[model samples]
Target: MADKRPQRGATLNRESNRFNLPERTADGDWLDDQAGIDGAPPRLRTSVTVERARTIISRNTSPDIGFDRSINPYRGCEHGCIYCFARPTHAFHDLSPGLDFESKLFAKPDAPALLRAELAKRGYSAQPIAFGTNTDPYQPIEAEWRITRGCIEVLSDTDHPLTITTKSDRVLHDIDLLAAMAAKGLAAVALSITSLDPRIAMTLEPRAPTPERRLAAVRKLVAAGIPTHVSIAPVIPAITDHEIEHLVERAAEAGARSVSFIPVRLPWEVAPLFRAWLDAHFPDRAGKVMAIIGAIRDGRDNDPGFFTRMRGSGPWADLLRTRFQIACRKHGLNRERIVLRSDLFRPPEGPQGELFG
Candidate 1:
């Protein structure tokens, strides 16, 4: 029961990964044997590596997902959300999914050029491209890299349809571009707000924008004539589940045109990390929360199937669905899905520099 909470700027203790291909594990026992004391862990620092992506658009045909093409301007989000399913992706780089996933990040500096090139290809077809599917396109580093902004510029200029999802209010910084795209029926956005309680949000998503800030952003986007939605994502069973109705009501009042929720998913490395997070912050209800999640996930920490994974199975899942539906109905949210038009899409005129050449 000692204080397991991470230091001021850190979220995890940087544990070794169990899924690492080389199978590495840390042994503190050796240090104890030599110095009769445990060695202090290294201080975590955020590092950005530039990735020259050969292609910026990723295609997927998952039956559960709504989009076929998506773009992630960055990898390994710095938001440090304990329940982020994208955390496990760090394992592919031989890094710990715990602290390293957040501290070490990648940016696609050439995404805009690559995207333009791809769109200009012979058989390229217009479709709504999704952003922030794996990591927040507007994460903190975005302020310096501006990769997402560049991609947005290309999309807007070509009149290509695009959808964005993020928990950060930084999306508002692009209001001009987004508003223009929306006017052409080429843009929409969804903001994810998990809990209204700042204390819970601090512990769960240490670096993400506050829930209230996200709500305000929703209002701003809606007022600007952008089709905006609010996502009460990863509704923890015993913890944040109680706030579902209140969240929907507040979102509706804030001018969200639609609302949706997803049950907590603990896939791969996220399972252990989330369990540790629960023990640290919500020790009292951690067991109950995991039990309910197990019930929804069919006695497992995760369900990887196509359709069922998005919405878990079992009575708990059914109850969550019913509660969400009732709240949406009561608040008059989700009246219609925002559909962006792909017909307006036209390939960007070859590289901007070419005109001068």
Candidate 2:
């Protein structure tokens, strides 16, 4: 079979799992252009599968991460961001970490009920439960599934503290609930804005909301009295790194109370996919970008070490840190961290007769 190019912003034409399976190559006559072979254009459609999870809460012991417990209402994201570090997780389902990770998705409809059950458990303890940690809770699918919204309803009912991180303006749809939770110090949100340049953003994160829309969301959230933060995440070196200061300024101007950033992370299958993206959209500087990234990661494509992973090592990393600090200080970002109150947690009413009995 000839190599089939993916749709714009999509990656990987075929499923390839590097783990628990050996690599396979297809061999046959190749054509320079396979476009008109069948007189039909290749179409990539998003498909969602329902996942019935027994438990909704996931626990992580990694010291590098902030929250210990998180709830992912969905698996896989439709945003099609080439640099998403969570891409490799698709391989566990015998799917490609490339295209399949974005095109194929999973939604957990029972998340709300499961979360309530867990919270009702006798020994359950409440801490900030994070959403959109592994996959975006507000991905396009959420508009239809509403699983994330349902989970939030459960959290809100119990006054359980939680944090959300997303790149979609769909979050605004739940503003009422979020506002109520915020009033009780039970909720906070962070919008991740990678680039303000539309051209770069279009190719980098194809289906996500535009930069302007995200900034608007920050304004809206802040205006509603809900603590809002902006995340200049996955700051690609030689690509989006230059926009750091400007992004911070714009977000801060838009009413974000705090700001944070993370350098691009290429873990597992994400490295190859991101390389392909660079070749497709930024061929001229692709090599230089990777070289700088390697330097930052200590001569590797990625650094998985807990502390070193989030903020890389070496001079490039130091420079980014210095630049970020200067910009934050100049723009008055990160004045304080939003701390949700876990003391307000109260388990929701149990089964109808059980509570009365």
Candidate 3:
């Protein structure tokens, strides 16, 4: 891998639609071609473009997922997680699913207005609106865009139920709004912590905040009377599976109400990208890791079969579930699932107020 793209998670940024992208590359033509006369390539920088969206809330009916609707204020996560399932989405725009998915971002500034309009529709019943299901709502760009903040404000004003999942401590920026809604039984938050080791974390999720900081955020959210959960997501078999018990212990110590784990799932272009990453970072154990994953996935690179997809099938899968259960029981986690209330939701009054009602 000639062009490792320092501080970025991808080893190769191949074209997703080409249909013949290689699994790995020794020479990164894209990076090398950009070299100056002195032969040093320029540092890659993130660029955000504004997207005018007619609608903000997206609906999904997948039985395997927990939420029915979700809102993503931004697209193309800056966290640059090498194993992100959402990476394939970049291909729709004719962009590379690798570096482009993380560096080239889109921000939806009209989300607040769109959300308010949608919530004001006549006879609209409320269910918890999910955030970060596809992309991180509180990624670094949120610090400047504040689009996620705006959407939350609208939800808070209407007393709507909502849930957020993120890896950044940046969610703390809106604790005031979340805590107020939570007091009314309307909000909950989940933070993803894949690995405790900073070195491993950096390579997996290059731009996310450190694991310790995320734990600190859980403590703060819990202290504020907000329902907080810790997620050990995409537990890389050989790489991060070792930290399950340790992460559970830390989450419990941080006052998290519950903890959950999801084994790695590579779908669409993510599989090849992830494979390239393994070759670059864990050459010695890459084959072993993939072999075990195939075992859990039923002899394939991935399994997209309803419930089986979320919780893989096979002895390895059974082992993971048992270990996770033991760890949670020992740490007093996952006693009950967190549920936000919809009874309190009120239709947005709109700028003109409730003229007809």
TM-score rank, highest first? 3, 2, 1
Q: Model 1, 1-357: lDDT tens per residue?
A: 112334322335344456535432432322235455355443345789887789999999998899999999998988888899998888877776776677779899999989888988978899999998999999999999999999999999889999999999999999999999999999999999999999888877878899999999999999999999899998999899999999999999999999999999999878888887887788898899999999999999999988888899999999999999999999999889999999988776765746864
Model 1 misses residue 320 by how many Å? Answer: 1.0
lDDT of 3: 0.90
lDDT by residue for model 3 over 1-357, one digit each (tens)?
A: 334677788877677765554432322434466444255344567899999999998999999899999999999999999999999888877677888889889999999999999999998889999999999999999999999999999999999999999999999999999999999999999999999999999999999999999999999999999999999998889899888899999999999999988889999889988998998899999999999999999999899999998889999999988899999999889998899999998788765676765
Measured with C-alpha atoms, the lDDT of residue 217 in candidate 3 is 98
Point out where model 1 deviates above 4 Å. 1-43, 351-357
Would you estimate the TM-scores of all the predictions?
0.91, 0.93, 0.94
lDDT, model 1, position 115 = 88
Q: For each predicted model, how many residue pairs clash, with residues at least 3 apart or on different chains?
A: 0, 0, 0
Weakest 10 consecutive residues, lDDT, candidate 1? Answer: 1-10
Q: Candidate 3, 57: how far from true, in Å?
A: 0.7
